[model samples]
Target: MIESRVLTQDVFEDLARHARRVEEAPWLEFVHGKLEVKARPDGNRGQIIAWLTRLCLQAYPDRWLHAYQGLRTETDGEGNARPDAVLAPIDTFVGQGEWASPDDVLMVVEVTSYDEDTDRRDRVEKPRAYAETGIPVYLLIDRDSCEVKVHSEPDGVRYEQVVTVPYGKTVTLPDPVGIELDTEPLKNWTR
Candidate 1:
């Protein structure tokens, strides 16, 4: 059996450079000096991200929305996290390479996949990380539950306010990006 290796930032960065040379390399993240691999988004997952990206960009033309953008959400060397979509001001991302600090992010979005690990991360782990990193909003589109949850007002490891809506309903985003997202398209999406 092959064992996974934990690498520091410098080592991880070097390996990443080489890994990208391969065809269809899996997404890699550094967590607490350990290398973590993430699966590529499947068809349904990609479609949902694309739709949300388009909708968000159309609603706020001046802002920027990027999929699979890695973020440095913590400072204690735990590692970086790549949200499904990151929303921020256009100017905030200039020249920012593979990973940007959470301070530059306005909102983070995650679309849960069918896998149990993916579900757990999106529902439990990610919210705490995003909130602790001081991200203003964490939007979760849970395919299994067929609902949308808006998490805001991060106080500690959790968001102080949470608003949930079914896939067919609309959810109003809070200040800084006050807009209603029509989740009807999400209803048609399957895992």
Candidate 2:
């Protein structure tokens, strides 16, 4: 039998520091004081991220769009999460380090990968976590379902407004990020 131990913030930071030095370290996140390892995204996932990043950058030229950036969703402990992409104001991210506070974030985009855990994290847990910190937008692209979900209007640990659209359609983001994302290319992606 194996026993599990919860890691403190300091311990988690130390592990993260070491992990960064390794050339081939898997993506690591500290979720509720527990270390969660994620595999490297495959080619299809990479293409989706790239497309979204490009679109976001083009849509909001004055903002910064970061891919796989670690976010600090909690102030008390290690509640670090790495979303597929983060959109923030240009001035807010200056001199920021590896982890950014969700308070400064304008929006978070997560593209679901090929796994059950990824589905739950992107569809459920991530929205709750991001909303808890009052992030204005949470955009989820669910490849498995061929759908895109937009979650906003945070109240408590959930978003008050939830909109879902199937692939080949367009989803309009709310004000501050008022752009319609076309999902035609995303619909062509296959497992």
Candidate 3:
């Protein structure tokens, strides 16, 4: 097996920027100081993000839901995460360069893809990274598991509360993102 190389934050950022300029290039994320390529969203995944965007818009008209917003999850500048979606004040990311700070972000949303890395990237690494960044909420819509996991109450290292409910159920996002999600529509997008 060939050994994979780790990239520094600067090198990763440069590559990420270059990739953004090319059409149909897979999204790049730096996690744990390693390069991770995320496949472009399929139709089902796009629909899920659209559904969540509508809900967020209805809940907080003053807030904006940014799809695929890159965030600096580590204070030490170790890695960057591009959440499926992020809800924050309308102008929170304005004028902020690539990889904005997560301070103003109210919540980060991740819709798991059918890829093999979903478990490690979305389910495991993301929660820890977002929590460490002090993001108020981390919403994981697990298509493989057919469940929604709401993680909140970040105390620096990890989210203290993790509430999991299967699809077709009602799940309430906690403080900082007080929105009720009717996950029934999510079932339509699940694999």
Model 2 RMSD in Å is 2.4
Better of 1 and 3 by lDDT: 3
User: Which should have the higher TM-score, number 1 or number 2?
Assistant: 2
Q: TM-score each candidate.
A: 0.86, 0.89, 0.94
Per-residue C-alpha lDDT of model 3 across residues 81-168, encoded as one tens digit per residue:
9888999999999988879988899999998888888899898888988888899999999999999999999998899999999999
Q: Write the per-residue lDDT of candidate 2 for residues 53-154, one digit (tens) a residue.
A: 788789888887777888887435247788888888777755677777777788898888887577656777778878877888899888888898999898
Candidate 3: residue 5 Cα off by (Å): 8.4
Query: Which 10 consecutive residues of model 3 have the lowest summed lDDT?
Result: 1-10
Give the per-residue lDDT digits (tens) of candidate 1, residues 62-157: 787788888876445356677888899777767878777777788998888777577657787678878878888899988888999999999856
Off by over 4 Å in 2: 1-5, 75-77
RMSD of 1: 2.7
User: Root-mean-square deviation of each candidate, in angstroms?
Assistant: 2.7, 2.4, 2.0
Stretch of 10 with least lDDT, candidate 2: 1-10
Best by TM-score: 3
lDDT (C-alpha, whole model) for all candidates? 0.78, 0.78, 0.87
